[model samples]
Each structure stands twice: as C-alpha cells, then as structure tokens.
Target: MKALSYLNKYLVKYKWYLIWGTVFTAISNLFGIFPAQLVRYALDLVRETLDTYHLYDGSTLQPALYSIFAFSLLLFAGGTLALALLKGFFLFLVRQTLIVMSRHIEYDLKNEIYDHYQTLPLSFYRQHNTGDLMARISEDVSKVRMYVGPSIMYGVNLIVLFILVITYMVSINARLSAYVLLPLPILSVLIYLVNNIIIRKSEEIQASLSKMSTYVQEAFSGIRVLKAFVQEQQSAARFEVESDTYRAKSLSLTKVDSLFFPIVAILVGLSNILVVYIGGQEIIAGRLTPGNITEFILYVNMLTWPVMALGWTTSQTQRAAASQARINEFLNIKTNIVSKKDINRSIQGEIDFRNVRFVYPDSGIVALHNFSMHVKAGETVAILGTTGSGKTTLANLLTRMYDVSSGEIRIDNTPIVDYNLTSLRSQMGYVPQDVFLFSETISNNVRFGRPDLPQARVEQAVRDADLYQNVIDFPEGFDTAVGERGVTLSGGQKQRLSIARAIARDPRILILDDCLSAVDTNTENIILNNLRRIMADRTSVIISHRVSSAKLADYIIMLDEGTIVEEGTQAELMARNGAFRELYEKQLQTEEV
Candidate 1:
C-alpha cells in the first residue's frame, strides 16, 4: 500500500472521475435493491386481498401493481444506463491516466537511471548484470502500471460497495444485520494474515521472475558463445531448472488462490444461514413481517460480493505493494557522481590530475595512488600498461565517470566537477575498445555523434577514419544496416566506424582507449598516420598494449599496478632499460619466432 503513494500525484489529477464512478456504483446498487423490495411489496398486496385499492380510496390494487412494476422497470433502466456509462467512462479515464502516467514515469525513471549509469564508475557496471537492468526498465515498470490501473479501481470499488451495502442492511433490520456482520471481524483478521503471506510470496515470485528473465536474456544474447562451446543441451537443462522453479512458484500461488475464495464463500454462507434462522423465527413469532424477512434476506445476499471482493482486492494490493517497493528501491538509488551545484563553465580539454587517488567503490585496492599527469591543449599522450594498469580508469576519470577519492582533476584549470557534465563530455571524444552500433545504416551510425553535421563533413570523417573504402565495398555501401550492435561488420570495420563517429564530433580532445585493437598492425599504422595528420592541433590520449602503437606518440607513460613507473619518449625509455624496454624486447622476440 505504501508503494501506492507514488500514484497519488497522478490520482489527484483525475479524482473527479473516481468520485463519479463511485457515485454511479452506489446508485446502481440502490436500484439493484429495488427488485427485491418490489417483490416483497407485491407479496404484501396479495396477502392483504385488496381487489381494488387507490392511494386515497385504498381500492385500486390493479393500477397500484401496474404502477409499481412500471416505476421499478424505469429505475432499473435508468440505473443500468447510468452505471454502464459511468463504468465505461471511469475505466476509460483510468486507462488513459494510467497510460499517460506510465509513460511519464517510465520516461523519468529511464532517464534518471541512464544518467546515473553514466555517472557511476565503470566498476559499478562490472559488478552488475546488463540483463537485470534491462528487465527493471522494461518488465518491472509494467508491474507498476498494473498496480496503478485495474488494481486501484477494484480496490476503491470494493470499499464503496461495502459501505453502501452495510448501511442499507442496518437500516432495514438492526438485529438481523448484526448477525450477518458477526463473521466480518473474523474474516478481516484472516485477510490481514493472508495479506502478509501474500506480500512475502509475491515478492519472492517477482524476484524469481526477474532472475528467469535475466537468464533468458543472457542466453539469447550469448547464443553464439553457447553454440561455439557446444553447450546447447546444458543450456537447455539449466533453462528447464529455472522454468520448473517458476512453475512451482506459480502453483504455490494457485494453491493460495484456491483456498482464498472458498474460505470467503464459507464465511458468507454461514452469515446467510444465521440470517435465515433468526429472521424466520422472528416472522413465526409475529415479531417481524414476511416482507421484512424477505428484504433482510436480499440484503444478506448482497453482502457476499463485497466480502469476496475484499479478499480478492487484498491479494492484488499485496502484490502491488511488493512491486512498488522494488521499483522504489531502483528509483531511490543515489548516484555517487553528480554534477556540481554551480556548474556554469565549459571545458577546452587542458586536463591535469593533481595528487589524485582512487579506489573502486566495491574493492579495497586503489587503482590510482598519488597519480599526477598533465596534458596540454594540443599534445598527443600515449598510456602504455598491462591489462589492469589503470589506463582505462584514467580515461574514465577524465570524462568524470568516476570522481577522485582524494585530490582533484581540472579541465582547462577549472575543477572538472565545476563544469556542466553535458558541456564537458561534449567537448571530448572517446572510442572504447568494444564498439557498439545501433541497428541502423552506416551513414546514420557515423552521423550519430553529430546529427546536424553537413553531409560533406560526414564523408570527410569516414575517409579520414580509413573506413570509406570498406563502406564503399559493401553491396549497399553506406546504407547497409549495421545489424544488432554492428554484428554485420567485422571487428576492424566496427572499430573504424566507431573512430569515424568520434571524428564526426569535431571534439577538442579525442581519447582512444585501445580502440584499434582489432585492426592489424598495418591498418593500425595507417589509421594512426591519418589521426596524426588530422588531429595535429587537437589533444589526444591513446591507450595501447603494443610498443609499435606507442612509438607514434610524442610522450609515453608506462603504468604498473596503479601508478606511473616510467615516463619518456620511446627512445628515452628504451635507453633507460626499464619496464618498457623489457616489454619491447619480449614482444620483439615473440614477433621474430
């Protein structure tokens, strides 16, 4: 129920529809009660043996009966029509509002989560599953919609129907009404207990469902790997296990559901029996009339639905509450990295790291300790390191993906935090090791970084990346769809297109984090030569494991563990006979063999 509060803001906007819906429901119930009362009155008229009765003469029984029937029919028609119109309109309003609110909330939550993801350090993503995040955004948000739409209307209708039916019953006969209501307190207690159980079970069900979705998503995405390893049967067996767990959970819920309705029916049946026994005795003793007993029976019958609805609605409420809590947990996660309050500056990519130290949030080992580095406006600096040597971490910190735990990083002499995130990130271009492309044409993918760029400029960037020849070689050339994540393209082609996309931005600083790993040494050298010519006056940071790649840079910095162990030109480091020399000699020997 606490999760329901998220909808209060939207509900308030459409309160009028809810009010009208409730009002019409009450009117319908009122008219619905008339049919029973009409029967009772006709019975009384016959018992009185009035051949002719009028209001004034007490003698025109035929006209009276005709009038009663006609008037009851009219009320029934009108009430039915009103209830239909109200129900239709109310459901329409609720659906429309829910759709609109779902869209808005989904948009807001997705944007917030995506923005948070961008700000979070790389380690966060390393520890989390991509499929789980996708499920939260797609499947979990849908659960929130169910809670807001049908569940809410049913819940409210249950309450209104209960009050209306109970009031009518008490007005007709107080003592008889008490007998029918005696079982309610016990029923309520049982509902409360069941609600707690349902909440816990429903949460477990949702969690299992999320896990199942994750497994399916991962298996599908990595079907290539699974088949490559010939693990199809093993994968199927694992899927069977997950499916069986889900089925078992669903059966458990069905068991609870089966018991729930029967218990409610039994309670209602007991109330009906009590009403009939006591009310029949009263009539026999002449303490109550036949018409009164009939009316009491009718009211007792009407109480059954509200009771059953109470149970059903309680179950839905518990499920909705659990969903809301999960959604809130995701929505409430605070991003560790956030833009400064007074972010009003732009960046020009003169970056400096002063005595900086950083440790991954989930790990104790520091990735960078007392690290100091400076890159002038137009110099190309290359970072050479082993796989875990903090090269990528340094690149990530430059983009503010993670904040320094101590000291500071300044962009253009201003603390990186003080510059607006969008403005700062827009000024830099980053080509990651793994390139990702949308399922779009090559031209569109290249233009993604700068949508408004002129066609000529786009073509220029493609040629500059040395990808133009490859694009032209394709049957459809630039219009060929890249397929999912650029699956249609080879590794080198994807890397080249990614470079083209980055170059399209015309950024002040370009960071290539091993972006050319898939390209052969010959192709790499060609791209590096082009980069040197095109970005001669623009700052660049190239990260690489190959000594050949680092040889093209004006300065090379070698990182070990988290700190820079050697810094100089290729000639200078080789002459010094340090770690760089050892790596260079080993690579030379491997190449010779």
Candidate 2:
C-alpha cells in the first residue's frame, strides 16, 4: 500500500472503480468459501451412519443409509455448481472495472508525460536522449499500471479472504485455527526481505534497459553514416556491450526473485502439515470429531493460495516503486522556459536589439556579444556572415527561444518576454538553416504553420518557394508522403517546403537563415521574385551567403566574429572594399568558373 502512493493522484480519481471491483471480489471469494462448510456436514453425516443427521430446516432426515447418501451427494453437487457460476460472474466484473481503470490511468499518465515533454525547454531535450525518454514513457508507465491492477487486486483479495476464512475457522475451533496460522507471520517476514532486494535490483535493471534503448535508437538513426564509413562491425560491437549489460542486470533481478516462491511454498506446506497432525491428535482423543478435522483441512487448502499470492503481489509492488522513481526524474525537472501572466500584447514587427549578449550553456561560449540592431516595421535587412558569426543566434533572440544573458530585445517597443509567447511566435515566421519536416504529405507540411489556411494559400506558398516545378513532377503532387524527417525528398525540396510552411503563416516578420543555399541562382531568383510582394509590407531578415540575395536587400550587414564589421546599403558596401565586398567578389569569381 505504501509503495502504491507514487500514483496516489491517479488512484484517487479511480477510487470508485476500485471500490466496486473490491465489492465484486468480496462476493466472489465469499461464495468460494462455502464449500468447506458443506464438506464438514458430509463428513459428520458419514461418521453418524445416517442416525443423527438433520435437514437444513432442523427436521429429522432419517432414512435408509443408501437413500441418505444419494440425496446428500445430489444436494452438494447442485449447490457447488451454483456457487461456481456466481463467483465467475463477480470475477468478470472485477476485471472489467479495475483492469480497465488501470489501462485508462496508463493512458492518462503517458499523455501527461508527453504533454509535459512538449512544454519542456529545448535545453532539457539537449541533456536527455530520445531512448531514455521513450523508455520512461512506455516501460515505466506500464509498470505503474501493473502495481495498481494485478498487484492491488491480488493483494486486497488476499487480505479480505484471510479475514473471512480465519474468522470462520475460529468459530469452528479456536485452538486449531491458531495452530494452522503459526507459520504465516514468519513467511511474511521472509517476503519482506526478498522484496527489499527485488526493489533494488529492479531499479538497476530498468536503468540498464534505458541505456540499451538509447544506444539502439542512436545507432540506427546514424546507420547511413555507419554504412558510408564501413563501420558495420564496429557498430555491432558497441551494441553487443549494451546488450550484455542489459542481460546481466536482468539475470541479477531474476536471481533475487528465485528465492521467494519456494520459501513461501515450504512455509505454507508446514501450515498444512501442522493442521492435519494436531487435528488428527484431537480426533483420536475424542475431543474433536472427524467432520471438524476434515473441514480444517479444507480451510488450510484455501489459505495456501493467498499465502503464495502475497509473495507475488509484494514483488510486483516493489517493481512498480522502482519504475515510478525513474519516471519522477523527468516529471520533477523545472520547465526552464516559462511565461509571465496577463501578457496579451500584440506585436507589429518593429524589432530592436540593444547591447544583447548570450552564452550557450552547453559549450560556455558567447554566441553573441553586445549585438545591437534596429529594423523598421517594413524593412528588408539581409545579414551576411562567415561560419560561427552569430547570424542565427541573433534571429533566435528576437523570438525569445533563449533569453539574452544581458541587455534586451524588443518588438514594437515592448520587451520580447512581455508579449504572450504563443502570440509573439505566431506573428513571426522562421525558417532555420537545418530544415525538419514530419512524415506527412507535402501540402500538409506546408500547411503546418496555419492549418486553417485555405488550399489556395498552400499552393501560393509552394509557388513562392519555387517548388511548383517539383510538385508537378511527382505523381502524388501535394499529397506525397515525405519519409521520416523528409528523408525521401532532396535537400533542396525540403528547404523549399520549409519555406512554404513559413510563407503560409503570413507573418509580420520573416527570418530566413541561409535558406536558399542549396538551390541554383535561377531558383533563388524565382523565390526572390515571389517573396518581393510578401516582404514589401513585413520586416524581413534574410541571412544569406550569396551575393544575389544581398544585392536585392535594402540594407546588408556583415558580421565577423560576433561583431558588426560593415553595415549600409549593398551598393554602398560594394563601393568600399569591405568584408561584404570581398565576399561578393569571391562568389562572382566562383560562378564564372
């Protein structure tokens, strides 16, 4: 019961289901116990040789010996059959009510974990592996259900059966009842000791499983790289290590479990032996009748089931406790990114960065240093930078993906954090350098940002991405399924679809981070042509390495080592031989080749 407290909230919600199931369970066990009483009456009737027997109505039932035996046998058979069916009916109710509730609770818990996973800060995902998270949600959730369902059912049934059976046994004969139950308390102590070991070993086993899952998931995700590098054998050898660890920990848990049931069998067997041995002595001394001894034996048989079940239920309980602790590890993490209350400010896309600074927590390196910039509500500002030059970092700050370590970023004169997170993010469109598409239809992917947008808008966005030619080539047109992470599509197609998604949002501000790098100048021109109308009334920040995109911008800024080295209209920067001009010349020379 103490171990079950980890799921206390869920238990409380389904308390009515549990109570009804217990009621049915009580009825089932109560019906099953009456057979022992019938056996007693039969044994005593045999002892009296049909001379002292009476009917259930307290009237004399004297008759010929063979006639009495036949009638008694018939009555016993009919009563037992009726009781069996009644017990079966209640057992069905128990399963439907309690087991079904456990399943529902499992779904609730898993969904709650997944929803929390979505709200967690991106840094939390960086620190945790996919396999570990998967194991917690799938494997751990199942174990918690096991504890509440089978463990609770068997555990409560054992207790309730014991109270009813023992009270009846006492009414028959107190001394014999005490003698038969003497070994039970000691057996309980043995179960406790074994369960302690089981809990410890189960925790270790679950951890090893998580590690193995992580290894398998990551290894397969990089299978293409492994094959390309001809490292198949090396990868297999690494997997062998994880598999071996998992197997070894599972065996250790099994080793502890092996000691439990046999000890319970031996102790319970002793109770039966003591019951028969002492009752036989009393019968021979003429103090107890043959009928009493026979009934006691039947009662002892009933006791064995609950005694054995106690060992199983306790072990199951310990396993659930171990899994619950692992799940809590994820649930207890504080959500790193949280919003303030009553923030309903709408953004109009005038952006400002005033002396902003940020250091990546994982690497402890400053990606941006005192970066300051301003863009009017409807200006096109192209950003130029070498690798590691903080272009993408600036875009991230404007969206408040990560709060700046120092200074402030503002949209329409309000701090980025002052507006509602959902409203602020929905107003801006962002296409990252690394594009990710779900395993969904091309049109569905394009419609992701605004699902309610019309199909005409989806086609328009796809045209703006210069994907019209590619869409017509595929047999499925917009309905084609992109494989996992859009692996079935070419890199350029994926980037175009990402652009289509952002474009369909009709954002107030659009940030494209080197989004047109994979396409040729002809397609880039087509994209630029389509985006001109969209960018005319919205703030656009285009990060590009190509001179074609830069020359079309109203202003371009060159970033070198997290600082602004040059900023002006493209023609002005090209007039002076600056970093931007040098990049422009290099791209022109490369294209001439």
Candidate 3:
C-alpha cells in the first residue's frame, strides 16, 4: 500500500477527473437504490387497493377504483425504468473521466522513464541488462495502470453503493439489516489473507517475467552466433526452462485467485437467505408486511455486485503495488554523470590528457594509469597498442562517457566537464572498433548524426570512405535496407559504412578507433589517402596496431599495458629498433607472405 502511495502525485495532477468521477459514482448508486424502494411502494399500494375493492364488491365506485389502481401501477413501472436509464448515463460518465485520466498518466509515466534511461551513464548499462529495463517500462507500468483505472473505479463504486444500500436497509428494519450484513466481516478477513498471497506471488511473477524477457531478447540478438555454434536445441531447452518457471508461478497465483468469486457468491447467497428468513418471521409477528420482505430481498440483490467486486479490486491493488515498487527501484537511481555547466563553447581541437588514472568500476581493472598526451590543433596523432593496452579508453574519456577517476582531460585548455555535455559530443565524430548501424537505408545510416544533410554530402562521405562504388552497385543504391546492426553488409563493408557515418558529421575532432581493421590493405590505403586530404585542417586521433596505419601521422605513440612505451615520428621510432620496430618488421613479413 505504501508503494502504491507513489501514484498520489499523478492523482493530484488529474484531480478534476477523480472529483467528477466520485460525484457521478454517488449519483448513479443513489438512483440505483430507488428501483428497490419503488418495488416496495407498488407492492404495498396493490395490497391496500385489493382491500378497498373487496369492500365495494358490488358498487359503482368499484369500476373507478380498479381503473385508478391500474394507472398507478403503470406509473410506478415507468418511473423505475426512467431512473435506470439515468443511472446508466452517469455510470458512463464515471468511466469516461477516471479511465481516460489513467491512460494519460500511463503515457506520461512511460515517457518519463524513457527520458531517464537516456540520462543514465554507460556504467549503468553494464550494471543492468536490457530486458529487465524494458520490462520495467512496458509490463510493470501496465500493471500500475490496472490500479489507476479499474481498481479505483470499482473501489469507489463499491464504497458508495454500500453506504446508500446499508443505510436504507437499517432504517427500514435494524435486526433484519444486521442479519443481512452478518457475512461482511468474514469477507473482509478473507480479502486480507488473500491480498497478502496475491502481492507476494505477483512480485515473483514479475521477476520471472523479466528473466524470460532477457533470455528471449538475447537469443534473438545473437541468433547468428547460435547458428554458427549449432546450439539451437540447447537454446530452446534453456528457453523452455524459463517458460516453465513463469507458467508454474502464474498457475499458483491463479489457483489462489479462483477462490475469490466462489467465496463472494457463497457469502452473498447466505445474506439473501438471511434477509428472506428473518423478514418472514418479522411479518408473522405483525411487525412487517409482505412488501417489506420483498423490498429487503431486492436490496440484498442490489448489493451483490459491489460485494463481489471487492475481492477483484483488492487483487488488482496488490498486484499494482508490487509492480510500482519495481518501477521505483530504477527511478530512484541518481546518475553520476551530468553536465557541470550549461556552456556550449566552440572547440579548437587542442586536446590534452594530464596524469589520468582510471579503473573500471565493475571489474576493478585499471584501464589507464598516469597516461598523458597532447595533440595540437590540426595535428594527427596515432596510438599503436595491442589488445588490452587501453587505446579505446582514451576515446571514451575524451567524450565524457565516463568521467576521469583522478586527473583531468581538457579540450582547448578548458576542463571537459565545463562544456555542455551535448555540445562537447556534437563537435566530435567517433568511429568505434566494433561498428554498429541501425536497421535503415544506407543513406540514413551514413547521415544519422545529420538527418537534414543533403544527398550530395552523403554521397561525398560514402565516396571518401571508399564505399561509394559498392553502395551504388546495389539494386536500390543508397535506399537499400541494412538489416539489424548492418547484418546485410559484409564485415569490411560495415566498417567502411561506419567510417562514412563519422565523416558525414564534418566534425572538428575525429576519433577513428581501429575502425579500418576489417578492410583489405588496398581499400585501407585508399581511405587513408582520402582522410589525409579531408582531415588536413581538423585534428584526428588514429588508434591502430598496424604500422602502415601510422605512416601519415605527425606523431606516433606505441603502448604496452596501460602506459606509453615509445613516442616519435615514424622514422624516429623505426630508427630506435625497439618495440615499435619489432612489431613493424613482423607485420611487413606477414604482408609479403
């Protein structure tokens, strides 16, 4: 219940809907009670009329009395029919206000969660998986909506109906009313016990749902790997295990839920029996009439739905509370990465890293240890490093994807954190080692950073990356669809397309992170020739292990572990005959072979 209290702000936001809905519920129930009272009045009127007719058995007045009684009964029936129609209209209004407001809240809540997800740091993604995140936003929010819409609606309807029906019953006959309501306390106790089980089971079900979603999502995303390894049967068996767990928990909850209606039905049946038996005894004592017995029976039937719905409303509320608590877990997390200032200053591409030390939070492995470098404006610096030598960490740190652990990085002599986060990233283009492209047309993927870019610019970027000829050969040319993650493209083609995307941004600072590794030497040489011309005035950092890739750089740094081992121009490092020279000789022999 306390977890459900989080929705109070949303209720306040749409308070007018709640107010109008409550008013309509009360009016409908008031009208609903009137038909039972009308039945009572008509029954009593008939009895009195019958007695009067007997007294005037052979008189002229008897004809007039009979006509009057027929007209009176017709009026009673018409009045009851009219009240019923009005009640139906107001009930329509109740749903219109409350249910529609719940939909609006659902829309707002989903957008809020999505926007928060975008703000979370890269580390946050590593800590949590994609499927659980999706479950919280989609499935969990839907459960909360059940409480907002139907539970609230029915709960209010029950409360209002009970007050009106019970007060009228007691006013007519206190002892009979007591007997009719004798099962209520027992119903309350049953609901209390059942709701605890419902909420606990609901939490377990939601957790299992998240696990199942994660497994399916991962399986689909890595279908290629599964096929390559011939693990189809194994994957299917794993999925079945998850599915069975979810199904078992669901069946357990259903078994408990099945008890609700029957319990309500038996209790409601008992109340009806009590009303008839006690009212008939009162009549025999001359304290009540046949009309009274009929009226009490009608009221008991009128109370049937609300009492039955109580169990359903409580079940929905318990599930909602369980779901909301899960939603709150993510919402409450405060992201560590946020812009320190709102400044959006232009960058001159003078980058500097000073005594930087960083350790991965999750793995506790030091990725960079006292690493320092400086790149002058319009200069190209190549970093040569083997795997695990921390080449990619430089790009991540400069982009502020993760902040520095100890020392600082700066662009144009200002701390990277001082610039607006969006502005800083916009001025730089990065091509990652592992290329990724959306499921869109080639042209769209190329110019993803600038959707409004002209066709001429898009074609020029593709041509510069040496992918123009291949793209134009396709049937649809630039309009051809690249399947998820560019699965339609070969490995070299995907890398070239990623390069085209980065170049299309026309960034002042470009980071090419082993992006050309998949391409052949001839294509790599041609793309590098184009880049040398295109990047003549912009600063660039080329990270690679091949000495051929470092030939055009103004300076080269060879790294071992997380620290720089050699720093010089190509000729200078080769002349030293150290680690750089050894690697270059090995690659030269491999190229020849």
Candidate 4:
C-alpha cells in the first residue's frame, strides 16, 4: 500500500472516473438485489394461493382465482426481467468508466517511465540491464493495470453488493442474517494469510521473469558469436535454467492464488447451510415463513461473489504494490549531469582540459589522471594510445557523457557546464570507437544528426568519408537498410558510414575515436586525406593507435596508463627516441613485412 501510494496523483487525476464507476456499481447492485426480492414475492404468492384454495374449496370461483394467480406471477416475472436488464446496463457503464480510465493511465505511466529513462545518467544504464528496465515498463505496468481496471471494478461491485444484500437480510431477520455471516470472518482471516504468501511469490516470479527476459535478449543479440563458438547447447542449457526458475516461481504463486476460490466456496457453502438450518427452525416455531427462509438464502448467495472477489482484489493489490515499488526505484534516481545554466552560447571549439581527472563510477577505474591539454579553435590534435589508455575517456568528457571526477573542462574559454547541455552536445560530432547505426536506411543514418539535410549533402559527406563508391555499388545505394547495429554491413563499411554520419553534421568540433581501425591501410589513407580537407576549419581530435592516422594531425600525443608519455609534431616525435617513435618504426616494419 505504501508503494502504491505513489499512484495517488493519478487517482486524483482521474477521480471523476472512479466516482462515476462507484455510483454505477452501487446502482447496479441495488437493481440486482431486487430480483431476489421478486422471487421471494412470487413464492409468498404461491403459498397464499394455496391457503385461499383451501378456504374456498369446491367453489366455482376456483377457475377465476387460478386466472388471477397466473396474471400475478406474470407481473412478478416481468418485473424481475426488467430489473435484470437494468442491472446489466449499469454494469456496462461501470466497465466503460473504470476500464477505459485504466488504459489511459497505462499510456501516461509508460510515457512517464520512458521519459525518465531518457533523463537518467549513463551510470544508471551501467548499473541496470535493458531487460530489467523493459520488464518494469512493460510487464510490471500490465500487472498494475489489472489492479487499476478489473480489480478495482470488481472490488467496488463487491462492496456495494455486500452492503445492500446484508442490509436487506438484516431488515427481514437479524438473527438469521447473523447466522449467515458467521463463516465470513474466518474467510477474511484465511484471505489475509494466503495473500501474504501470494505477494511474496508474485515478487519472486517478477524477478525471475526479468532474469529470463535479459538472458533471451542477450542470446539473440549475440547469436552469431554463440554459433561461431559452437556453444549453442550451452547457451540453450543456461536459458533452460532461467526458464525453469521462472516457471517454478509462477507455479508457486498460482498454488497460493488457487486457494482463493475454494476458501470462498467453502465459507459461502457454510453460510448457506446456516441460513437453511436456522431459518427452518424459525419456520417450525412460527417465527418465520418459507418465503423468509428463501429470501435469506438469496441474500447469502448474492454475497458469495463479493466474498470470493475479496481474495482476488487483495491479490492484485499486493502484486501492484510489488511492481510499483520497482518503478519508484528508478523514478527516484536523479541524474548527476544536467545543464547548470540554460544559456546556448556559440562555441568555436577551443577545448581546455584543466588538470582533468576522472574515475569510472561503476568500475572504480581511474581512466584519466591529471590530464591537461589545450587545443585552439580549428586545430587538429591526434591522440595515440594503447588499448587501456585514456583516449576515449577524453572524448566522453568533452561531450559531457560523464563529468570529470575532479577539475574542469572548458570550451570557448567558458566552463562546459555553464552552456546549455543540449546545445553543447548538438554542436559536436562524436564518432565512438564502437560504431552503432539504427535499423534504418543508410541515407537516414548519415542524416541522423541533421535530418533535414538534402541528398546532395549526404552524398558529399559519404564521398568525404571515402565510402561513396561502396554505397553506390549496393543495389539500394543510400536507401539500403542497415539491419540491427548495422550487422548487414561489413565492419569497415560500418566504420566508414559512422564517419560519414559525423561529417554530415558539419559540426563546430569533431572527435573521431579510432573510427578507422576496421579499414585497410590504403582505405584509411584515402579517408584521412578527405578528413584533413573537411577538418581544416573545424576543430578535430583524432584518437587512434596507427601512426598513419596520427600523421594527418598538426600535433600528436601518446598516452600510457592514463598519462601522456609523449607529445610533439610527427617530424619532431620521429626525431626523438621515444614511445611514439618506437611505435611508428614497429608499425612501419609490420607494413614492410
């Protein structure tokens, strides 16, 4: 209930729906109860006709009396039918108001969750998996919708029926009503005990489901790798384990849920027994009529559904509570990176890393240590590094993907945080080492940064990235769909397409992070030559290991273990007997061999 309290706002938002649904439920129950009374009247009339026949035995008026009795029974039946139709109409209205409201709420809640996911920091994604996040938004939200729709509607119906039915029973005979209700308290206790178990089991099932979904998603994403390694059997076995755990937890919850109907049925049967036994005794003592006993039984029967639904409503509420708690966990997380000031200033790409130090929050790895550098606007500086070196970290910091742990980064002589976050990132074209293209056409992928670009611009950017000839060779050319993560394209083509995407943006600053590693040396040279022309005016940072890529830059810096080991012009670095020169000679030797 405490976790579900988060939905109080939405409840208030759609308060009118709830109010009207409640009204319709009450009206429908009122009409439903009257049919039982009509049955009682019909039975009483039959008994009265019997007495009258005895009084007027052997009279010629017997035929006329029978005609009158027939007419009276028809009136009672018509009244009962009318009341039933009216009850059904209001029940329809109840569903319209309540169930429809739940669908609307479901839409709003999913949007809120997805919007929140967008605002969450990168670290949040590092901590949580996609399947768990998706499960909360999709499966968990569906469970909550059950509570909001059917559970709520049925619960209201139950309350109204119980109040009206019990009131009528008591009005007729308080003692008999008391007897009929005796088993109800025991039923309530049982529901409470069973529901506690249900909530626990439901939570376990949801967790297991998340784990299973994650495993399946990863397996599909890595299907190629799995088959290449001939580990399909092992992967399937692991999936089976997860699936079995999910099945076990679901069965455990169902077993607890299964107790609900039987418990209600048994208690309701007990109430019916008490009503008959006690009401019969009263009739024998001349304190009650057959009609009174029948009416009491009808009232007990009317309460049966509501009593049974008590268990169902409570079960749904508990499940909703568990799910809402998971949702609230993500909603409560505040992103650390946000624009301090909403100022969109023009940046000329003069970047300054003033003693910048950064540690990965998830891994506690110091990716950069007291890194300091300055690049004037329109300058191209190539960053050289080994695999674990801090090359990509520099690009991440410049783009504000993760803020520096200590010290500061400034662009255009102002603190990066001072600029509007969106405007800041919008102006910089960043191509990561790991390329990712959407499952969209190649033309759309290249124009992703600036969607309104004309085809001429897109083609020119492709030419600049040394990918024009390859794209033209394809049957669909620019319109060809790059399947998930550009899996349809070769690794080199994907990298080249990524480069073309960055080039199409015409950004004030461009940071290419080892984007040329997949291409051959000949192709890399052609792309670097094209890049040098495009990057003449715009500030550029090229991160790579190969000396060929670094030679395009006016200045070069080599890093080892997060610290710069060498920095100089290519000619000056070649003159020195340093790490940079050693790497250059080794790479030259490899090419020669």
Top candidate when judged by TM-score against the true structure: 4
lDDT of each: 0.77, 0.84, 0.92, 0.91
| Cα RMSD for candidates in order | 3.8, 3.2, 1.8, 1.6
**N/CA/C clash count, model 3:** 0
Question: How many angstroms is residue 494 displaced in model 2 relative to the true structure, after the best TM-score fit?
Answer: 0.7
- Clashing residue pairs in candidate 2 (N, C-alpha, C atoms within 3 angstroms): none
What tens digits encode model 4's per-residue C-alpha lDDT throughout 440-540? 99999999999999999999999999989999899999999999999899999999999999989899999999999999999999999998899999999
lDDT of candidate model 3 versus the reference: 0.92
Backbone clash total, candidate 1 = 8
User: Residue-wise lDDT of candidate 3 within 1-593, one digit each (tens)?
Assistant: 89888889999999999999999999999989998889989999999999999999999999999999999999999999999999999999999998998898899889989998998888889889899999999999999999999899999999998889889988999999999999999999998999899989999999999999999999998999999999999999999999999999999999999999999999999988897899889999988888888988888888788888889889988998999999998888878777787679888899999999988887788998898999998999999999999998888888888988989898999888888988989889899998999999999998898999999999999999999999999999999999999999999999999999998989989999999899888999999999998789899999998888887799998888889899999899889999999999999999999
lDDT of 2: 0.84
Give the per-residue lDDT digits (tens) of candidate 1, residues 1-593.
Answer: 67778767656665655566556555555555665666566555555533333343644566677676567556656665665565566555545544454456556655655675566556667776776677666666666655555555566556666777677767777788888889889988988887777888888888888788889988987777899999999999999999899888878887776667888889888987887898888788777677777777777676677678778777877776777677667667667666776576545668788999988777776899899989888888899999988898888898888888898998888888887777778878889876888899998988897788887888888888889988889999888999988878898999999999988898888999998889987798899888988678788889888787776687899998889999988899999999999999997897677
After the best TM-score superposition of candidate 2, give how far the Cα of residue 48 lies from its true spot, in angstroms. 2.4
- Local error of candidate 4 at 348, Å? 1.5
- Per residue, candidate 2 scores C-alpha lDDT tens digits across 1-593 of 45456588998899998999889888988988887777777777676755544443354444464576878877987887889889889889989888988898899999989998887766687788999999999998898888888888887788888988999988877888899989888987888888888988888888888888998898787777889999999889988988898899889888878787788788878887887898888888777887887778878787787878888778888888888888887887877555655377656789888998888766688888788888889988998898899988887777777888889888888777677888888988999998999989998998898888888999999988989889978999989999778878988899999999998999999999999988888888888988998898899999976768875588888887788899999889989998888888898898888
Choose 1 or 3, whichever is better by lDDT. 3
TM-score for every candidate vs. truth? 0.88, 0.93, 0.96, 0.97
On the 0 to 100 scale, the lDDT of residue 520 in model 3 is 87
* Cα TM-score of candidate 2: 0.93
